[model samples]
Target: MNTINTHFRLSYQIQDEAFKLSQAGNCNLYVAISSRAMRLAVADVERNKFVALEDYELITVFTPLQIAEQLRLIADQSPILQEQRWLDVRISVSNQFFTLVPETLFDPTHQEDYLRLHSNLDPQQHVILYNRTFGLDAVNIFAIDGVIYRMAQSVFPERTVQFTHQTSSLIKSVLHQTDRNAGRVMHLFVERNYVTVLVVDENGLQFCNVFHYLSPEDFIYFVIFVMQEQKMNPEQETITAWGDITPDSSLFNMLKKYIRQVKFGKRPADVGYSYKFDDLFDHRYFELFSLHFCE
Candidate 1:
């Protein structure tokens, strides 16, 4: 439950006093939850404005019970949790699940069976099932797990919130942002223990997979392996990186050594953010910000 990374800020710190005094009834709160951390961003929805309000990363833990307890404690202390209007929450699970089923046969009743066929673990430990309703009765549904779901619901009303795998938001944002004329696009959302690689062309998603890493080499290997297996040429394809990455992180340097375009992504252009969050890295917290458009 100890804090591994903590950075929480409010409007008055970054906004002019006049702006802070007048921010009522105009905002929406968005949260992105994962095993390693939790991030909160508040946006004045009517104005398309946003500011990342806080970030909390948990210290190393040995068990799921510890992880869940730590996550709840972090939520218990956030003042934003007390404000319940216009909330959108996304829970990220590391389960690498993808199923191709037709819409006619896609019954919500079969959710557990589909995931169970692919994963050999206790469903009691992970009880969340989320899918994309925006696509053509298409194949490839996602299943997310862990304490993030329960923690999210525990803090906010389940009826008023939207839930999906983190990749749903990541893929949604990247597809809209990627330039189709450019041919191929590769996006990497790097986190502490996981790296999600999403690849696409003008046609649509050519590949999507998440890899867990124990070292810098493992990270680079997955990057190269996907590009290789997908027949994407690193020399020609554009790779737009985002998420918890920084200019100095070894993940950045490792990608630079092998690829041509390992640049960071721009914040969603459709959303306006307060100058209060200017101190943050522009490329980070993208999924949390893009959750503004989830509904």
Candidate 2:
């Protein structure tokens, strides 16, 4: 523990009855990978209910391989890691290289071309993925380190196939919960060092991107910039938010100062939660909880 940066021990054992049900191989493992935090959760695949969850804050950043080794260690230590269920990996890396390409023209084999849209595509260090998260007739091409992907697979094996962008699933979660039958809306997911902004209407996803920030000033700047880029008026558009957000936080206070319609989002209505989870913040952990809606 001395060499590690910030290791917050995560422990949540389900009740005897819940443990028996989970042992039936009915739960799926959801892991959120990021430089800021690594969170794990178990959900009933059949009923889409949240069973238990835990997280770690990685204050001391390490090489991607080092982080992978840490994750393998975590998987090895968890009692439920051996369960025969799927492992869903959500990418929340700080640097995002993404582009929207038409589905008809998007070739999975040509994923690197789209990754090149943002920067010089790095094949050796980065692995690329072309995904159709939004229902639009287009696919998003993005990349993370190859080491991270392989490390996750090595831990979970054949059960780990679903890979997706953080913004994609969070956008879907927001849309699924919002009454989008009316008008265009915006949403934000704020973490300690990063902020993700998304705008959508009845049509589909309008804009999605992640920005890195060190101070509260930098945080609100990016949020407002996204709104302006999307031509969304803060007064008219509702901006629902979650993940490391609070009404009293400097970030939220700045958001409310400018955006009249700003408010905290809710958990997905379809999922059930254990009483143990009641102690966690409702405004946070939406990314971990929203993994249920990823599929």
Candidate 3:
């Protein structure tokens, strides 16, 4: 049997952070910095091992500056490495402050590239939209394909079909019956103050807007408005909340209270996907642990 070899290299300064590298192939190299001292040490290493001795076949230096001059020198001497895309140029900044920078500053084309990269990386990507307010808690919407599925407001390990299916049908009915073309709605995510809805079919994800509302009524109104703008009907749609609601002060009950409060009128229908929050991840653990010392 013949083995295939692959390598990936990444470099970052103390201020910079890399979320995750693409694992498209077998080889990966990641270099991150924590302090000014580390950055200086990296610079020294680049000068000696990278520049003077030329010890490695692939070398990428992550620095604050683009260093066009240094890149030119490296490209001239290290033709093979440059041809292999071994060099990555990046800026160094504090991790705390970097997130504060608007996406436009890093790259004007960040959104396009971000979506493309994510789509390529995870073809079966499931989107979850969550929002939390004082009286109105979190509403999570998971989008798979063009269909939006709702997750329970609270996170649970075990899958519950009642909330998931109900939420899916509600959104499906709303979108299908309404004038809004599902194809136009591109991406959706939850942000701090509001739910950021992106619609990018032919027009691209640029036309989408953030809907800001303090209450669930207002939030629903905003959804209606978007639907109406695209010509969706108000009467034809129903919004139902899903998740487990317990009989006692249990996982099921808590989720039930939340769903009833937001969805209105409808009672939670049991779909046989219920489980204790503690026993959600591994039910066998709960069972085994319970029987460990019992007679």
Candidate 4:
């Protein structure tokens, strides 16, 4: 069955043979929406494994209203999303307008002030929200277009919705996987037009930021620049990559040429996936899968 709305194309839809729409009450739903893409992942708590996923890629940059309309179309056709009741529903927004503040200095009332330092947010057009880091002493201040938030609310009006930023999901998953004894680890999460670089070490979250790149050269430049700024050696330390990249892709090849040890990352180990998922790359849909770890 093809479910391609004019605005967005369904790239892939995978589900376990045993997944049942009637049993959605036992499943948790995660929906991640960004300007360029939208994704859905379903985890079955009863089986401790992910049972379904639907990934969509947008042809062009979409405004908040356009994104919401596409989401509504997906909701109308996706069997997994058609169910009225689910055990849990979490939505994450991926955008450039976000900033992280240490919990010690975070004032809930000054969220807009904190975020303004990094990106501009129009109160009338965007909603300012924050999510506390799972294992770190920080708060991620981010914005979601009002149109998108309201659309999600309308789609799942019967269920309580939890909102978060894509960065929150990446940081939580990286922190959980970081081994204190391992010294320092850098992760590159490649999106359609941007890359999120995260640096964590024995001490704590050392650095996290996003950089937009237009070419493979620009992509590797940002990677190497961040390593230099952090005093890491590309010829020595290992970097793990996730999302929007294939092993034989030009992006991966560029990384390998510049860095001595580059490897693909796997999903969170705590959660399992159905055998059906084995056909896919473990590194793909990391931010969506990592949402499972969000509070």
What's the residue-level lDDT of 203 in candidate 2?
Answer: 77
Tell me each candidate's TM-score.
0.84, 0.87, 0.22, 0.96
Q: Look at candidate 1 and tell me the lDDT of residue 198.
A: 87
Question: Which one wins by lDDT: 1 or 3?
Answer: 1
Residue 220 accuracy (lDDT) in model 2: 80
Using lDDT as the yardstick, the better of models 3 and 4 is 4
TM-score of 4: 0.96
Q: After superposition, how far is residue 72 of candidate 3 from its true place, in Å?
A: 34
Task: Please report the candidate that would top lDDT against the real structure.
Answer: 4
lDDT values for all models = 0.68, 0.71, 0.25, 0.89
Predicted structure 2: clash tally: 0
Candidate 1, clashing residue pairs? none
Tens-digit lDDT track of model 1 for 1-295: 6564333222222332334313534666666666666676677666677743677765565455565665566666765555554434444444466454556777777777776666664666666365663433444466544565565677776435666666667777877778877787788988887888988788866677778899889999999999999888888777888888889989889998889877888887787878777777778888777676556
For every candidate structure, what is the RMSD over all alpha carbons to the true structure, in angstroms? 4.0, 3.1, 22.5, 2.5
Most accurate candidate by TM-score:
4
Instruction: Report the lDDT tens digits of candidate 3 across residue range 1-295.
Output: 5242212122221211221122112211111111111111011112111111111112333332222223233334432223322222111111111111122243433433433432332334343221111111212222222111221111112222122211222232223222344344422222212433333333223233445555545545555566567543334433322211123423324323333322322211221111221232221111111111111
Which lDDT tens digits does candidate 2 get at residues 15-125?
323644344366677778776677767776666677767676664565787677666666666655555554454444434667777788888877886678676766788
Task: Write down the worst ten-residue block by lDDT for model 4.
Answer: 1-10
